[model samples]
Target: MKSKITVMLVDDHAVVRAGHRMLLSQYENISVVAETARGEEAYQRYIEIHPGIVVMDINLPGMGGLASIRRIHGRDPYARILAFSVHDEPLYVTRALEAGAKGYVTKSSAPEILVEAIIRLAQGDTFVDPEIAQRMVVQTVTGTDPSSLLATLSAREFDIFRLLVNGRTTREIAEELCLGYKTVANYATQIKSKLNVRTTAEMTCLAYQYGVLNG
Candidate 1:
C-alpha cells in the first residue's frame, strides 16, 4: 500500500486555506491533515501532528512562517517544509532555502504546482517555482544592485519589509503579520541596517528609489 503524505497548511487568511484545502482534495497521495492561520500555532501543532510536509506562508498572524520553520527545524532537523508565498524576490527565495525548506512555490503559480511541490518535497527532492527562481537569481548573481537591497533580506525580514513599504505602521505590521510588536520592531531595524537607513522615512525613500514599490 502507498503511504499517504500528511500535509499541513499554514497561512493567515481563512479563505486561502479553504481554497488550498479544496485544491488538495483532488489529489490522492496528498492529504492535508492539519491547518493553521498563524505561525505560532503551526509550530505547536507541527510537534503534535508530525506531518510529512508543511506548506507555509511567510506572512502569518503570530510568528512569521520563517521563524516557525526555524523552530520546527530545531526540533526535527529533517522536517520537510515548503515555503509558499506571493513573494518572488531573491530575499525570500534565498532565505527559505537557507532555513532548510525543501521547496519554494509562489502563490501566483498554478494550483498544480502546489501539489507538484508537495510531492517533490515529500520525496526529499528540492523544487522551486520556475518563474520565481528566475526573478530571484538574476539580482543576486548580478553586480551593483541599487534597488531595494532585497537580495540581502531573509524570508521573515522581507515579510516585515513588505508591510512597511505598503504603508503599514509598526503596530499594524505586527498585527498583520502575527508577530509581537517588539519582534516586528526588531525586523524593521534589521531591514534598515541591511539597506543602511536610519529611519522609516529613509527606508520608504530608498524603497521608491530602488523601484521596489513599482515592483
Candidate 2:
C-alpha cells in the first residue's frame, strides 16, 4: 500500500488546529504528522518531521506565518507549504507565494478546498483559492495597484506595519515581535516614510483601502 501523505499544521489557535485535524483525519491518504501553535516552532517542527507538506496560518503569534515559510524554505528550498489565511486580499496571496508557499487557501473556504489544496501541494502543484484567483486576475487587468505601498514593505516591516495600523503601540509591537523598542521604533519610522503616511490613522486608512484590514 502507498504511504499516506504526511502534513504539519501551524496555527496559533488550538481550536482551529483541532478542527483541521478532525477534517483531514477522514482522508485515508493524508496524515497529519505534527501540529504547532506558533510560527516560530514551525521551522523546527518541519526539520524534525520533514512532512510532505505544511499547512500554515498567516496570522500566527510570533514571527508570523510568512516569515516561517521563508525560514523553512531557507532550510529546505523544496519544502511544500500551503499558506492558510483569514485575509483573502490579493496582497496576502502574492506575499505568500513570494515567500515560497506552494499554495494559498483562505479559512473561509470550504474544508474540502483545504484538503484539495493539501493534496495538490503534496503532489508539487500550485493551488490557489478560486475566489482569490479570480480577484488576482481582475487586479492584473485593472492595472491599479492599491497595495503598492504595502508591497514595498519587507516582511518584518510589514508585520510591524500591520500591528501599527491595528492600533498597537510601538512598545506593544516590540514586545509582540520580540524586538528592541528602538528597533521597532526605527521600523515604524521607515514604514511611515515608505508608505508616505503621517500617522497611524493614515496607515489604518490605507490598510482598509487596500483590503489589508477586514471590517
Candidate 1 all-Cα RMSD: 3.6
What are the TM-scores, per candidate, against the unseen true structure?
A: 0.80, 0.93
Q: Per-residue lDDT of 102-178 in model 2, one digit per residue for the tens?
A: 99999999999999999998788999999989988988999875786788999888888878877788998788778
Candidate 1 lDDT tens digits, 50-80? 9999999976655677777877888898999
Candidates' lDDT values, in order? 0.81, 0.89
Q: What TM-score does model 2 achieve against the real structure?
A: 0.93
Model 2 residue pairs with clashes:
none
lDDT at 75 for candidate 1? 88
RMSD of each: 3.6, 1.7
lDDT of 2 at 44: 88
Judge candidate 1 at residue 80 and give its lDDT. Answer: 95
Q: Give, for candidate 2, the lowest lDDT window spanning 10 residues.
A: 206-215
